[model samples]
Target chain A: SQTIHQWPATLVQPVGSPLSLECTVEGTSNPNLYWYRQAAGRGLQLLFYSVGIGQISSEVPQNLSASRPQDRQFILSSKKLLLSDSGFYLCAWSRGGRAEAFFGQGTRLTVV
Target chain B: QKEVEQDPGPLSVPEGAIVSLNCTYSNSAFQYFMWYRQYSRKGPELLMYTYSSGNKEDGRFTAQVDKSSKYISLFIRDSQPSDSATYLCAAPSSSGSARQLTFGSGTQLTVLP
Candidate 1:
């Protein structure tokens, strides 16, 4: 069985501060990884996705970025946080060229 | 217009009632459809997915897709309080060689006990 791990579960940061969220997958290799931000009544917004290491495609242009350092390790980062950058962030993985996605427990980020 | 759209229903129903959720997409090129369930303050969990224009059932849940109309539906039978959550439908769009998912604004359902 494959499992995705993301941390920290919750975070409270001041404005203009840097942000770093890590996600990792176990029991699978070369999986497709994605970062999504879900707002209340706004739906899940795809921020970034990576098909392989060192390759990242950003869907939405904002204050966030994603990186695939290893085959199963993905990281979401922000140089400076904005008040609008607060939401429930989710990390998900899927098989290459497939649509069935498995999500990790999300991180609730609050930028005050 | 958005590629995919869903009714944002804060629907309330009694336990053991039948529940239905639906979504519509604007793209006919979307070959795959998926449904996800999200609890309050949690990540959305994949519940069902299909590529063809038919119905697929798993236990108490059924997923229906109509490629001709670009419509997707999910039915939950014998609904319980645990079934209370937001249901979202998605379709994948081509992005380079990879694919990025586009999701609908979820429909919130509460099954009271």
Candidate 2:
């Protein structure tokens, strides 16, 4: 079975501070990875998605960026955090084409 | 207008009652549809998935997709308190290349014991 692991399940970062959230998938290779920010009543907004290593697509322009360093390792980062950047961040993986996506536990980030 | 739309409902129901959740989309090109459940402060969990139209059932959950109407629905029979959560409907990107998904605002359901 495949499992996704996200670190720092909860984080409290101050404004203008750097942010780094990691997500790694085990038991799957070359999977499509995605980063989404979920806000209350706004649904899950796709921030970035990667089909392969070193390839990332931004769905919404903001203060966040994503990277795929390895086949199953994805990272979401920001040089400086903003108050609006606070939300429930989720990491998901799917097969190459269209398929059911599996999500991680998520990281609750609060930018003060 | 948004590609997908769902009622942001905080619906309350009694235990053992039937629960119905719904979503509507404006994009006809969307071919795949899905439903996800999310607990407080957690990630959305894929509950049911259907392609195109028709109905698909899994245990106590039934998923219905009406391509003609561009609407999808999820029904939960014999609902329990454990089933209380936010339900989100998702559709595939029209482009189909990235397999991206556009999600609904989600409906919050609470089953009282």
Candidate 3:
């Protein structure tokens, strides 16, 4: 069975601080990885996706970036966080050519 | 118009009542349709997935897709308090460039005891 693991279930960071969120998947190879943010009273927005190692596609241009260091390890980072960056972050993985993706527990970040 | 439109209703219904949640899309190229349930602060969980048009049922949940009308529905039979959550409708991106899934705003359902 395939499973996704994400860290820092909840985070509280000050403005202009650096941020790092990690996601790792097991039981799959060359899987598609995605990062999504869900704002209050809004739909989940796609932030970044990776097709393979060292390849990242960003949907929304913001203060955040994603990197695929390994086949199953994905990282979302930000040099300086903004107040608007506060939201629930989710990590998901799917097989190539598949539409359904599995999600991780998610990280709730609050910027003050 | 947004690609997918769903009513963000804090719909409150009595237990055992049948709940109907719906979403409409403007994209005809969307070939895959799915329903996901998200608890208060947890990640969304896949509830149902369907392709093309027709109905697919699992246990007490039934998913219906009408491609001609560009509408999809999720029906919950004998709803319970455990079913209280947000239901979101999703489909793969039609743009072919990225495999990201587009989502509806989501409908919040509350099953009252």
Candidate 4:
């Protein structure tokens, strides 16, 4: 069975601070990875997605960026965070032409 | 306007009652539709998905898609308190480079015990 691991479960960062969220998938290779943010009362917004290693596609230009360093490892990062950047961040993956994605336990980040 | 739209209902229903959730899409880029269930603090879990138009059932849940009308529906039979969660309808967009799933605002359902 394939599983996704993401961390830290919760984060509180000061304004202008850096952010890094990591996610890894086991039991799959060359899987498409995605990063999403869910604000209160809002749906999951796609931030970034990767088709393969070193290939990242961003949905909307924002303060965040994603990278696929390894086949199953994805990283979401920001050089400087904003107050509006606070939300529930999720990591998901799908492969073999499956449209439905499997999501990971999200990280609740609060920018104070 | 959002590509996919949901009621975002905080609907409350008695246990064993039937529950319905719906969403509407407006464009052709969305080829597949899916329903996901999210607890209060966890990530959304894929409940079911349908590529074409029709109904698919699993245990206590049924998913229906009508491409001609661009409508998606999920029905729960004999609902339990464990079924209380936010139900979100989503579809993949082919217009953008990401080609990832676009979601609706989600309907929060609570099956009261």
lDDT of 1 by residue, B1-113 (tens): 99999999999999999999999999988988899999988888999888879999999999999888889999999999999999999998877666778899999999999
Select the stronger candidate by lDDT from 2 and 3.
3
Q: Is 1 or 3 the stronger prediction by DockQ?
A: 1
Which digits, one per residue and each the tens of the lDDT, describe model 4 over residues B1-113?
88999998889999999999999999876778889999999999999988778999999999999889989999999999999999999998653433578899999999999
Residue pairs of candidate 2 with colliding backbone atoms: none
- Chain B TM, cand. 2: 0.96
Give the Cα RMSD of candidate 1.
1.0
Please identify model 2 stretches exceeding 4 Å from their true place: B94-96
Candidate 4 lDDT, tens digit per residue, A19-79?
9999999998889899999998889888988988999988789999999999999999999
Colliding residue pairs in candidate 3: none
User: Model 2 chain A — which ten-residue stretch has the worst lDDT?
Assistant: A94-103
What tens-digit string does per-residue lDDT give for candidate 3 at A1-112? 8899999999999999999999999999999999999987789999999889998988899999999999999999999999999999999998888889889999999999
Write down the DockQ of candidate 2. Answer: 0.76
Best by lDDT: 3
Query: Which pairs clash inside model 4?
Result: none
Score residue B71 of candidate 2 by CA lDDT: 89
In order, the TM-score of chain B in each prediction is: 0.97, 0.96, 0.96, 0.94
Which of 1 and 4 is the better model by lDDT? 1
**What order do you get sorting by TM-score, best first?**
3, 2, 1, 4
Whichever of 3 and 4 has more TM-score, that candidate is: 3
- lDDT, model 3, position B50: 95
lDDT of 3 by residue, B52-76 (tens): 8999999999999999999999999
Q: Per-residue lDDT for B20 in model 3?
A: 98
Q: What stretches of model 3 exceed 4 Å from their correct place? A: B94-98
